[model samples]
Target: MAIRDDYIKWVILITILYRVGTTNSVCELSVSHGDKLYNFSLASPTWKYPHGVLSEDGFYKIARNGTVLWFQLCDGLIFNHDPPRCFDCQDCGGPSHCGMGCSALVANPLGGYYVCTTIGRSSSTKVNLIDEKNPSMGVVVKISSSGVLTNCSLSVSVFCDSNGLQGPNLLETVGTCDYATVLRHPSGCAKTVSLHGNGLGWFSTLLIIVLCFFVAYLLAGTAYRYFSLGIRGVHAIPHLEVWLSLPHRIQGLFRSLIRRFRRPTQGHRSTYSPVNF
Candidate 1:
């Protein structure tokens, strides 16, 4: 062992990045929500594919109600309109299974070992996952609803017949029902629990609006007062009148004294004037 270890001398290389090969290469996937479009490929093991599953080419874009963490085979043959179901062997003298007499199953690239037991759910609790070597393609989505976890699994192999990818966040199912629910509905919980007090949100919004109005009124009043002061300063400020005592009575007495004492000068007519003592 020592001699072999010495012979196999370890060589060290220095680099900033290293690369690993993954079998997630696929044609294209396009997903759409509303008017937006997004494009993605299944070539990265670390990459999580969003929903666009069987409807579009390789692009999908929208605020999703659910997410697609992994995408397996996406083909037109099996998943064109509806999901696949086993019909010929509904009661074919054996336990129920998927792909019993379906022509599509018979022509599967993988030997008839991997059976399609159920379209949506299965009795078995454990589900097996695979890579591209066996031509197995599937995707699992991890649904988080108010922190509750749920798994949704879909076999893309039956549809695409090609490649797939899986991420750490991808969920694996224990039974077919779990898988079916995940694919059918991605969001685990239909209802969300409130983190804060109920109706507090609306109350807070209303309070903010009221506060805004109050502040506006205060500002307007202050502005009006200041504006009036500014106007008085800009134009001339009016002065109040002041009074002395009994000026009108004194003026009447002086007028009587002047009338009794004064006589005409020369022939000139008396000039009219306010009487003064």
Candidate 2:
């Protein structure tokens, strides 16, 4: 009996945790700033330039002075050519020379190419990606600084354009280290549901939890009856009589409540009754 109770408790706890995790997972795809909520789930997938100038492959690329930079939105960069060893990008790079969201190939004065990655492992699903405050711009998703060099960062300013998939266009290059880009995508727009608004209400959430517990209870009770008490068929259901009469019991309870709160009847009295005396 103790073992069965423990099993039921574990099942109930797991079910509650699963439900809560599912609810929180939805919130992870969005960001809240001030009074607005920006849901970027639509643009969560990896986005790359359709055409490449230097190479036939697709990825955003730009050349400045003698340095060439390559990057992708919402994901890491994939290299089509062999890249040099980068000691700083151990966890963020692969054998194919692909690295996190952005990479740079710089020409050395001594005549060899030096390859390094700037932004490391940025994804839309990651929470707190919009930590940068840009009051003029509605939403900004900035990647955490993890570069081969010090103080290197990437900032993407997202603008609302319901019909635009316009850009990850390079806006500015800050001192050959930091890069800023603008992405005009539909996901930059505010969602109808805000961070603290119009999701499943508390009452509905409670109802779901109660229903789950009730179902679990019934299953556990039924199993116990069948296996431990040698009961079979419909008789295996625990508290079978109580459940069957629950509707009537509920109705009776409501009726009693109504009567308790009902107004009392008032008897009619004639004002002329004193004339007979």
Candidate 3:
């Protein structure tokens, strides 16, 4: 009994291994920026969450859990936190048209923000000018599935007045992503009803074989009679045996019919009569 149990356990272990090795998720992502494009990422955070656990990997990896934001500089530096060059445009695209302010646009890799620049001139003797760069864009996030992983991507675009004053907007766009942990049941593993196995099962199997033999026997008798009618080549031994095994009633009727055919007809000439010279 112990040995039998061990064998069953071994089989189950093999099945589990096969299943796990084949199980994994696929993720993909793409981000569209102003003229240029950049790959978005989910990186570790310096500030801890409500429970002291730093939100790493991404903001919306699981949804409704963390924040998602991404920012890039003109020189090509990407950040998640407020950077020195970024300034807020609270009123420019916010509930209040405050026109200008500062806020957290990219909160990862240190607090960074996007900056929109404006040119100003002095009214003094010589033309003097002051220039300022402010956060002119916001982060757009996208996530999708890849093999065994879910990849999160981000991009930055120029904000128009039509664009809202939000810091991070989860733009749901049709894009590909490579993300991990998006596990799913593998194909061809789901349950389905199949006709191949639906034979009345073993009981039906036995019935089918018996029925086939019965049908073959019935056909063999009919074939024999047709063959014996001078059809020449059909009077084989196998056909004779099949015909002889028919039920008494059928056999009697068949023999009677055969006798009528064998009887001489009026057109027949007697072999014993001598031919006229």
Top-lDDT candidate index: 2
Model 3, 1-277: lDDT tens digits are 9999999999999965653332211111123333333322112111222211112221212221232222221111212443233344232223232111211122212254444221100110010001112212222222211123323333323222222122223333223421111111111011123335445788788999999997887567556755664444445335555556667769789999988877665336554578798
Which parts of model 3 have CA positions greater than 4 angstroms off? Answer: 1-66, 69-110, 114-197, 229-277
Supply every candidate's count of residue pairs whose N, Cα or C atoms clash at under 3 angstroms. Answer: 15, 0, 45
Model 1 agreement with the true structure over 14-130: per-residue lDDT tens digits: 111211111122323334323333233333222223433332332111112232221222221122332333233242112343332221121111243322222221111122222
Per-residue lDDT of model 2, residues 162-261, tens digit only: 6746665465766556666666765555453455666798999999999999999999999999999999999899999999999999999999988766
TM-scores for candidates 1 onward, in order: 0.19, 0.41, 0.22
Indicate the residue-level lDDT of 123 in model 1: 18
lDDT score for candidate 2 against the true structure: 0.54
Instruction: Mark the 10 consecutive residues where model 2 has the least summed lDDT.
Output: 49-58
Misplaced by over 4 Å in model 2 are: 1-38, 42-58, 79-96, 100-115, 123-138, 147-149, 194-277
Error of 2 at 201 (Å): 16
Number of clashes found in candidate 2: 0
Q: Rate the local accuracy (lDDT) of all candidates.
A: 0.30, 0.54, 0.31
